[model samples]
Target: MKATTFPGMSLDIDIQELTPVQWPALEKLFGKNGACVGCWCMFWRLEEGERFQDVKGASAKQRMKALVAQGQARGLLAYVEGEPVGWLTFGPRRSFPRLDRAPSLKCDDADEVWSLPCFFIHKDFRNQGVATALLKFAMDTLRQRGVSTLEGYPVKVPAGATRVANSSAYTGTVPFFEKQGFKSVAERPQGKQRMRKSLVLRRSARKQGS
Candidate 1:
């Protein structure tokens, strides 16, 4: 589907500015289930539950909250009439240890880029393209900041790979990334669906009269 299919639902949602004050809503969204068993959506954050296995839920949340206070903008928030319904975590890839574990993602690039790490949509508002909009906003924000490289780890969905409920598999699916205009520059080095997109470049201002 397309955005138009969901009439009166308003794909023209308000992409709220994320702030520490809004942390509570995010916390509620994750709940005691750990945002799918206490992840706080930190799937790529650890290597098969090594580092994060000890962090627990409440403490991990505290850590993320601190990030917000430390001037770390925690991605975009998808809101419907002031209620936060979805989220997309976008930032420099280095900050999220999850992506580093995947050699195929190649975190060593010094060019400095933003990563569309993951998306979380409220149960009620899912399938409405909310994540896609948040993603687009993230890209637009990055572009305005002069960022040209963005990456997302989606899925190759092996032929006949049986998908299950909440089976995000951490890495998103191919269709989702493709919808945002991302292309596969690499394949599964450790996992599948490592996609990339090159943003439109803005010409640098010439040094007066140069």
Candidate 2:
């Protein structure tokens, strides 16, 4: 378990990558609704087809499980005092088939580029820095794994907007990505902006400063 602490918060936050054996923890975190719309974090991973619509809840869960079984980078779960509270979905850009059709979002030619497609934080943990902690953990983990770049598709929303639901913010807010050192590289026609971070450059800078 990787732990981080913040001032005034007594408990340490731990984030961990999911394995087939830890599926139960994710099941417990997502609960009965399957993390909204029976997605199971398979929204971008699968192509849009009748089969996709047909596999609503349980089937979607199985599909994600099968991906996890493939042994590639799937995502990480955040735990506070041993209870799972948040999730971040990330992996090779091509692993998500739907990206090919996404307007204004295209993968670069680099083989080591990864994409962060979504985030889900439990209701109780919202605005508590859990997502930020998870993001930091993910950056370090990916850098150590030799990822060249990281990309994200976050929504461009007005500041302090309460009209949006938590579920809709799954793609993440632009400010959140900015705080993580990601810069806007492009924007979609529909207002979803693409952000990129060069892990390779950051690593080089850190080493130089050291």
Candidate 3:
């Protein structure tokens, strides 16, 4: 577990990678609504032609649990005072086949990139830097694992707006990604953006340096 304390915040935040052992914490965090209409953070993992409504409730929860059991799902959970308050899911681009169907969001180096597709923070924890802390931890963890690049698809809050509904910000906000050193690489319709960040020096670059 990684502990972090943000500026102006008194509570210490502990972040841990999601594992089968941490399943109960995730369950508590997602609550009965399944973190936005029973998504359970599985929207991006949906297969082609799969209707979300078909899996919106218990089915989606089961699928996510199965992924957790098989170690196919990757994510981070943040805790404050031992309560899970935030979550972020990321993995190899191919893990989220739905991205391929997203118009104009495909990248040339898909095989080499990891994607951060979902974030959910407890209602009481919103705007408290929990997501920022979770994101920073994920970048560090991914970098140590030899992931050179990371990408995010965050919703763009309209100009002059301070905030959007929690549902609208499920993927995160463009400004948040920009603050974390991600640069806008492509645009998706509906005010969404494809952003990219280099997490580590490429293997070739490191070899040349050595």
Candidate 4:
């Protein structure tokens, strides 16, 4: 697919895997609010008590930095003319502790699977295709890494609703995932839906091509 311009942004967008060196870019995109009340994208990594009690902000940022520094399987960042504009995180389902107990989002298979639970697009880049683009990039990255199955937990957007608020749509909408070749595998509580995709690719070829 051709690179497309992000709305209100001058240059075309590109996606790159997140790294420790890119912390500054993530911080800049998240801003002082920490991308939804200081979440820093660690809402699903923390324990239930911590996530619900509002124990975020600098602490959450530090935790995420630790993950990046440790070379843990994180997500990718979207850049437009070198400015970070979006973030999408995913990894082995086990890497995320909270998913173990998330109602209706629990593990359903024993095979190796990656879970994409969240995304954060810069306020200026919202309503654009940033999230979708990042998701596609993620699929290719995962496939090259030998991942065969990918799962996602998305929200069910109300029928006829033009737009959902950022806070409620962080997990993505069902329709969006479907368009990306994901199918509904299960339904979770609170309008949440579980989706999955089986990938077919020559993992060895990716390494050789590189």
Reference-based TM-score of each model: 0.80, 0.87, 0.90, 0.85
Write one digit per residue (lDDT tens) for candidate 4, span 29-145.
Answer: 889988998888888887656654466888888887787888784888898878999999988888777877776777657347788999999888886778988888888878767
lDDT (tens digit, per residue) of candidate 1 on 1-210: 011122344565777657877788777766777666666766554545576767757766776777776757467677776677787887777767667666667656724767877777788887787776777777767777788789887766666665424456445677778888898877663346668898865345334425
lDDT of 4 at 196: 92
Assess candidate 1 and give its TM-score to the true structure.
Answer: 0.80
Candidates' C-alpha lDDT: 0.69, 0.79, 0.88, 0.81
lDDT score of model 3? 0.88
Give per-residue lDDT, candidate 2, residue 18.
76
The most accurate candidate by TM-score is 3
- Give the top-scoring candidate (lDDT): 3
Q: Which residue pairs clash within candidate 3?
A: none
| lDDT ranking, best first | 3, 4, 2, 1
RMSD of each: 5.8, 2.7, 3.2, 4.6
Looking at candidate 1, the ten consecutive residues that score lowest on lDDT are: 1-10
Model 3 misplacement above 4 A: 1-10, 188-190, 201-210
Off by over 4 Å in 1: 1-12, 43-50, 107-111, 161-164, 189-191, 202-210
lDDT of 3 at 37: 98
Clashes of 4: 0
